[model samples]
Target chain A: MTREQEAAVINAVLDGDVNAYEYLVKAYEKNVYNLALRMVGNSEDAYDMSQEAFIKAYNSLHSFRGDSKFSVWLYRIVSNVCLDYLRARNRKATVSLSVENDDGEDVELDIADEASSPQALLDRSLTRDAVRRGLQALPPDHREILLLREIQGLSYEEIADTLDLEVGTVKSRIFRARKKLCAFLIKDGNIPDYVSSSKLRGGDLS
Target chain B: MNMCEYYQELISRMLDDELNNQERKVLAEHLSVCEECAAVYSAFSMLSDTVANDLVEPPEELAEDIMAHIRRAEMRKRNQREQRAKRAASRQIRNIVAAAACVAVLVAAVGGVSVVRNLRRSNAVYESRKIESSSGTTAQGGLVDATVLAPTPVPTAAPAPSSAPVSQYTAPAAESNDNGGLGSIIRSWWGGDDGWFSSPAPTPVPTYSVPQITPPGYGSTVTPEPYAPQVAQSEAAPIVVIPDTPVVTETPVVTEAPVVAETPVVTETPVVTETPVVTETPVVTETPVVTETPVVTETPVVTEAPVVTETPVVTENPVVTETPVVTETPVVTETPVVTETPVVTETPVVTETPVEPQLSMAQPDTFSDAFIPENSFAPEGMAGTPGMDMSFSALPDFEEAPADFAAVSAVSYDFSEQDCTEFVNAIFGLEEETADDAQSVQTDAAAAEANSGAEQYLSYIDKLIATEQLVPVTLPEELLPDRTESLTFSHEGFKFSLDIRFYGEQMCVLGCDGQGQQLCFMSDMSAEEYDTFVKDCLLLNEVE
Candidate 1:
């Protein structure tokens, strides 16, 4: 829904036409459900988490300040509900993707160059299952931000607002998150680490 | 990796379409040369595409389930509201009933005169009625008089000293009858009669015997101790503890002698004294002559001796001579001393005259030194119109004049005659100007005080808002802030107004209706609850 339509529906629900909330639920359910699905890795729990998030949003609908898009605000609540569920289940992220060096800078992974063009390799090898496995394998923080950015198509600024992070932090974290997913994909043997053939040397460019 | 790190961050921004032209061009140029960064960019792009395509359909019943939960919640809330309204209605009914009961009692107390009379008869009856009527009246009119009268009649009737034991024996029997009468009166008033008028007529008969019988029984037994002391001392002691046994055993011997002997012994002494004194004193000449001789001789001798001796020897010569001599000597001596003191005082007056002349000699020198510069400078400036010459010559003296004037005023009031007149005129002019200036200053000060007072009040209101003691609200246009009234705000889609009243030190915000009566469902909430309610209203306004 457009922001104006979303605001109208929210106002109607708050104005005692409680059934007007169904318009919001229908508009954002697919993205919210998919975000929860990607976080929890199961459909039943995903459905339950989505419902809880919607109810919580409805209960606190008066607190919405309209500082951001309604979807961004809703996604924040969705992510918080799923995070609480993950925390309650004691499912700590298995892989720590963003490593800090002695200087407290994120240590990037060094991928070995292979002899194939990257676009052709990505087209042939980057399957949906591989991406899902890589996403599921990611730490919950990185997974959440990436899902907000990719699955929900939120901008970095919108992600920053939703997650209450600085825009610079959002950019760096998304980069680190993408690198970690790529490393995961490589480790899972789903794709080759191929560089484009026109390079003098791709590794020397950094 | 170090060089690629910055470009890689740009590449991530590029994927998100966040990079500006400069960074985009730089990242594009680097990616054209850098195979590793290019491969990473391609991987990120494919991952973004894949994740964006991976939308899952939610369960069909999800929205229905949410709506179901919400509906149930709304139903529960509606039920709670209904229950609260019912509770409020019942509370209002209870208040009305209580008010009606109060009115009934007031009507009965004021109009029921016979009820008051019936209540006065029994002592116990008076006490019970006092308890019932205590809330309505002072319980005083006939009831207090009856209680005072109840104990008196029995003691007065049986004044014969011998009846102490008899009255003590009858007192308890009379007490039981009083109790029975009181109980029946109370039962008639409370149970049978409708509590107002009908019970008064029958109640008086039974209650009448109580005051009469009980008081006399107690009175003759208790009061005769002081009246008939002989019987009381012997018999009343034992009667108090074991009243029946002691009174029965002791009554026969003690009762007859006290009654018979007590009367004549009381009357015989006065008769004996009166008859003997009258008959013998007039008939016996020897006794009269003997008594008269000593009285006559002693009166004259004692009276004449002291008067003649004391008057001549002590009073006349000593008082007259000593007072005259002593008073005259002091007067004569004090006259000389008073005369000599003026001579001594004249010497100091003569000495002070010289000091006055000397001070006069020194006064003119200081006045000339101080006033000459001012006198010289004022005329020279007026006399010389040339700017350079006046500024050069008179400025230093002009500065010195004010210094000299301040110093001289501090030091003395002495001034030359002409300067003094000019000085007085200048002071008069300054005083008038200062008076006008002071009035204007006071006006400004008053305005400033008012502004400061308003600021203090506003600051206090701000502090109250900060501490949540008072909730700042935007009153609707029709409502005045100074009046005790309510403002309507919507919460959860229901429009309601809370009456804002200040109760002494506290601000009480209660849910009220159109008539301004507090809703029974929202009565007497605590301070914290009021804060919560006000915050909820503010939040609802913000949401709207």
Candidate 2:
């Protein structure tokens, strides 16, 4: 929904037209549910979290300042509910994808040369399954920001606003999260590394 | 790897379209040179696309479930509001009824005052008239005696000629002669006969004189002359002669003597008794009227007492009922204030004041460690150790104490029974008489504690007991002697040690929970109890 239309619907809900809330719910439910799924890594917990987020958003609808996009605000609630759920269950990240190299700088993941082109990778269902598995393996904080930026299609500033972080932190966290996902995919052998020797020589020259 | 790391972060930002043109140009230059950066860029871009397309549809019933819950919550809120309004309305009605009862009592009191005032006025009037009638009777008797003595000389002068008949006649004549002698003499003198001087004329003449004169005198005389003659005739034959003469003289006197004798009879008896009788009869009749009025007034006055008594009784009943109801509400409301502010405020001050020394002495690891050397204290400490253990085990059972106390209080207004049974059972486990005595002490202590602002703490302790948060531990009687003391076992595995000491008239029970929160319970103490408790504490200190 557009910003003005979303605000109008919110006002109607606040004015006691409870049915007006269904419009906002219907518009955002898919994105909210997918974000919750990526964060929680299970359909059942994701569904419950999404419903809780919507209810919390409706209950505190009057506190919405309209300064941010309605979806960004809704995603913030979804993110919080998911984080609280993960924290309550004490779910630790299973795989640590980002590792400090010998030079004390974060190294970008080396994707295979065969998966170099976006169009070629897009055609493969195996790459999509590998990406989903990789997203689930990332820590909750990194996964949350990545979901907001990529799946929810929020801008870096909007992701920062949703997760209550600085834009710089959002950029770095997203980069780290992407590097982790790529490393997981490469380790899983989803991408064939046909040109790794040539890339390593080029990296040493740089 | 370092140069590639910088460009890759730009690549991550660029996938989100967050790069400025200059940074994008730098990132594009680096990506063209670095093959690893290009692959990373392509993979990051492809991953973003795949995640963006990954959508999970929510269950269709989610909105319906949420709305159903909201609707139920709204309904619950509305019901609570309605119940609150109903309670407020009922409270208003009770207030109006109490106000109306007060007005009714005021009206009854005013009415009773007026009735009493009317009775006093009527009583005053009756008393004044009685005094006047009594004095009037004595004055009339004096006049009758004067008239009787005045005629005696005339009879004595004629005594020689009729001495034989005079002896017989004088006895009968003497009585009536006392009343009629003056009337007959004056009448005879006026009629030219000297009948009163001729006392020996016959006993019949004196008797006849009495009836004739006495009728006119009936009103003035204290004694009713007509009633006197009837009484005398029944008693004596000489009085019979008076009736015979009246019959004999009736025909003759009706024509001539009535004119001659009645004028003299009227003139003489009125002169002698008519004035007095006229005054006396009306006075008598007035006194009767007054007496009759008093009788009438007295009956209503007697009725007024019951009316006054009954109204006061009715007034007193409502007042009595209203006082407790009004008093109890204040006590209930004040209890919270007492508990929250005053009790909390005073507890520390009382503990710090006189009990500072005892607190320092008792601050050892265990009470028994500090107190074991004293002769009287060892048994109590040893006894109390097992008692404390029993108290912990028995703590759960005393949870029903508060509910029982509430039920008992609801059934009876007499606090002694409920307080004694609950407190004794819950805390002391003392005998019934000891419980009774302890309850009385507690009542006095409660009243004194209320004055000193420690009542709130006691009542708060009471509330805690009621809620089963605080468990009452019975202490040995020798520990505080004449003072009631109990240790409250802590909740949630908090270790607490209790210290009892007196500060002024207040008995302070101080303890610290495992979390370091200070819990102080205060009760009032009489001066004598304070002295005794102080002496015992000092004895223990000296022995130590």
Candidate 3:
């Protein structure tokens, strides 16, 4: 948070304006959702876990210490609550995104209306399919850190803050998790020899 | 760092932009050379890309559900808080009242306890003191101890020294009398039967011709005593045994004795002098115990003693000033403790004494509206229950009374036993009781009419018949002198009429003369029912 915004929040919380907590909730909701979806390997669970984490944060906010940012504290609570829920339900059975790669099978369209743009819907549908297949192949833990970094757009420090870990640990986990996902996508042939020679600090990103 | 670990971390940091340019360059160069780190880094990147693009949105209602749940929680908490506040308000008052009641009980109990303790202590002290004083007066020390109960409980504790040394052991009654035959009886009765320490086996209460005040409920009036005297009550430190009721009357008093209480009703004879003191020396006759206590009669005192034990300090009697209140304590009047033997002595006497059952009211020669039985001689309490000599009191006001003393006497005459049983049967939905009493009334009427011609029918009684309806009647004083009128009714299509005429005298209520009336049942209702059906309905409405 900005210095001014952080102070305002702290003041509001101290003044007992609990509803002001929504500011913090909305800010961290995406990152928390990404982490939860990856850990639980499901969309429905991810959404529920994210909402529950924020609610819990709101309730036990008084127990929070300023040693860490609010996002990190929230991340810790969400990860633990979702992990426990998945563990209790035996997380092994939980599936990741359903983006399956079609080797030879014809895909059906969910959009049946004539007014619907068939090509646009098809593109979106194919994207989901490819992503799902790639995600499901990667283990939940790896898939989670990557998503937090990629989509939720959390920085190394922010990710560490959310996952309740050191910046070094976050870096290591993300690296290992990415390595696994890359291997799966390659085996599925989703990427066709794709080292496009992106800009590197001193050498090619390839 | 080894090339492998170095590449792993470098690739990881590069994925997050955490490394500096130099490190990123090294990681890129390492990844190009190392197949393992490159594979790991790419997999991580792809996974992150897919999950974020595809998965999270919840169904819509959950947010609303949470808000509703919160509102409900707040409402419940508010209700609970309000309830707590209400209870707290009432609790303060209840606690104060309960506390006051508790304290009052405690004080009264303490007062009573201290009083009894003082009395006992005083008795021992008085006896010992008397022994000290009379050491030279009487030569026989053995008789001295038994003979006297000297120093009374003076409010201060100093009198314990003056107490005489009487034998702590109870002495025989003969020893208590000390050669004076009636002295011990007077003392025993004076103390009113409590803590007779050295006085042994109470002087077999000699049957003094004491008037027995029937305490509230001993059936009848016991005999009044003659030649009883009020002895020197305040001074003589006397003890007395108060036998149960026929011996002493219980005055109604509040029962405020403590929980653990042995309330010995000390109905003492207080002196009329300036010092209204309760003396141990007194007459054992039936005198109204405790005086005209402005509060209540004496029983209230006895009852209050019990209440005192429950409350330690009280608002009603705070600073129990030992106010020399000769006034009786508020005693709860014991319910009519009806003694059987008293009933034997009393009821027979009243019955045999030839009570002037004569209401003695002279009938107006030409009775006016004022002479209506309901206004004047409506039988009060003798309900139509057979042979029960019902003493009439709580009777409802009646409009008219039947004529003749026999009719009045028959107020106790219950011929409706059959109909009553039938009503009872219908209530239980069963068959009725036998018509035996009803038959008797019918036969009794027939026999009475045959014995005397209608002109001379002064001893006849009205026979109530159920033709369509059954009406309970009350007879006036003048009408009780003769059978005046007969009314008809119908019930459930059954009909009956009463044929009535005067009988005799003094056998009925309010008079020595019983004006008897003859009764005959005319059994028929169909015609009677048809004739006045609407009027009957109107009467039904007016019956109440």
Candidate 4:
């Protein structure tokens, strides 16, 4: 939809036609869900984070300001919600390991099925899994940069706006992040160390 | 690995296609010569491919779930608002009853005080008359005549001695009438003549019962204590924290500007305006040095009058004065530091220039797929199929046998393994006009050779056989003495432009430069190989 149409829907929602918000939800749901999934690293948590972000966006609809694209603004809300969840989870992870599950409180990552059979692990695409693990291993700041570039396909300027950073910082940061991920992939054996040396001998490039 | 480290970053940027033509040229040469760096490049490409290929499908119910959650939240909000309204209504009713009871109590208290005061006045009059009548009939007759003699009203005359305090009432009328013996006796008794009359008006003793004056916002009617030295009147200035209704009792005071003025709020305005201006002046003055000097001086000149008006003004001026001086010196000292902020800002612009091409290169919609061009090469619509080409240990060969020409063999050279000193010197020495001249020469020879027609077929064969060695495209006029290495060839009518370089043991064409409208070829790619690579791998439209 055009920006004007989306803005009109937003206006309708704000004008007490609360159901008009459904159009906005429908328009961005897929991308928002994908962003949340990448950020939090799990389907269930991603769903929760997506819902939380939408609810937050709805609650603070008056503050949306409309200066930026709705998608960029919405993604920022999703990113923040995921960051909050991650922070809470990290905080919980640092605490005692007592069985606090019954309280339905925030808990450390369950690590559900992260470990697989050796065959399954081998069969898994080394690049895909390694890159995923590499992304997870990076600091949140760097990881977000990679996701916005590689996954979301945001330009340096767009990422800068989303992250509230200078564009130059974004470029150098992305370069650094890609380097780190390459290092991680190499260290984790997703990429073989001797690949370049082996290819040093003459062979057909075609 | 150490040799590969430098090229590692370049390889990552290459996979992202963030490199400009110049950097790409450097990397291409490095990769051809150094297999180790080429392998790193391949790994980086594979990592990009993985991220691009793994597309996660969002849950279908996502929109529905969001809408349901919003609806639930809205319902919950509506209920909470209704409850709040009900609570507010009940609380408001309670407040009304409480206020009504307070008014009733206040009225009763005022009425009781008025009744007591009236009773005391009547008693004082009766006692005075009895005392006068008992003294002498002649004196009483004189008092009656004197009452007629007074110009004041009869009621005022009766209550004069009865209600008013003796000290306050003794002034005008008592002095003028002092010639009358009765009046003189009264004055003498009031003014230290203790023998004649011992306390004439006992009712005036209830001075403590008079209501005290209290300012608004204070809780009680009692007069407040004097202002403390450290506590300025402005600090005691009342803030109207009340939201909906104004406090009726304090309405007259809070509404009056004079009341605020009395509390030094007027003085505070100049101080408040001056403080921010003084603190801001140094910063403003440093930036616009010419105009601001006068402004700073003028502010002090304007403040000088108010400063002389009161000691408070005097104290405030020094604060503003000292603040500007202290802040100004640091700001001046920080001018160099402030100057450094722009330098830091300029660094970003320098850095930003590099990103501009990356932006123009990585155009918006296609960039997501740009890094994963490998996905487009997926055999027979096998796009997004994970683990399809995870192996980067060896270069993959396409064997559908479609091309009539034999595979263009890889010319192994490490463009990455350049000596730092030699590489820097070579790059600096290669001017664009000189390179362009060489490229023109190279293209013309290839075009002439291909235009010769018989030699065209031979050149294609020459390109394949020439892969075994580092064949430098000889410049018609030696562009570089020892460093120049590249292959130029033509197939059909098109001439291939190449810049081949040999760094130590690594020998390969470094990069392709389309100096004019002409397209160039990588060192290892013959005409047919270039065609297949373009078709199968590179998106022609994406060539930035």
Candidate achieving the largest DockQ: 1
Clashes of 3: 140
Report DockQ per prediction, comma-separated. 0.30, 0.30, 0.21, 0.25
Model 3 agreement with the true structure over B241-284: per-residue lDDT tens digits: 11111111221111111000111111111001101111100110
> lDDT order of candidates, best first?
2, 1, 4, 3
Per-residue lDDT of model 1, residues B1-544, tens digit only: 4878788788888988898999999999999998677877777787888889878789999989988998899889889999999999999999998897677556545534433332222222111100011000001110100000110001001112121211111111111111111100111111010111001111111121111101211111100101111212222221121111122112121121111112211111111111111111121112332111111111111111111122222122222111112112222222222122111111111111111111111110111111011111110001100000100110111112221121111111111111211221122223444334434433554455623321222233233335443343321211111111122222111222222332222433322121111111112444444445544443323210
Taken over the whole model, the C-alpha lDDT of each candidate is 0.37, 0.38, 0.30, 0.34
Report how far off residue B360 is in candidate 2 (Å). Answer: 86
TM-score of each: 0.40, 0.41, 0.37, 0.34
- Best-first order by DockQ: 1, 2, 4, 3
Cα lDDT tens digits for candidate 4, A165-185: 997787767766665665555
Docking class of 4: acceptable
Give residue B44's lDDT in candidate 2 (0 to 100): 77
For candidate 3, the lDDT comes to 0.30
Question: For all the candidates, what are their Cα RMSDs to the real structure?
Answer: 41.7, 37.3, 26.8, 55.2
Q: What global local distance difference test value does model 1 have? A: 0.37
Choose 2 or 3, whichever is better by lDDT. 2
lDDT of 4 by residue, B1-544 (tens): 2446556666766666667899889888988998667766665566566665566777878778888888888899999999999999989988987886576557645644543442232122111100010000011111010000001101101111111111111101111011111111111111111011111111111111100111221101111111112111111111110110011111121111112112222111121122212223334334432112211111111111111222132233333333323223223222222222211111111111111111111110011111111111111001100000000000001111112101011011112122211221133233345334434544654677634221332332233225422232321111111122212222232222122222233332321111111111124444444334333321211110
lDDT of 3 by residue, A1-206 (tens): 67468657856865666556556655566677766766565677777787777667666777876766666666778767876785587434222322222232222211112212456446654435445544445555555566667766678788777776787777766765554444344433444233312221112222
For chain B alone, what TM-score does every candidate structure achieve against the true structure?
A: 0.23, 0.25, 0.22, 0.20
Q: TM-score of model 4 relative to the true fold?
A: 0.34
What DockQ would you assign to candidate 2? 0.30
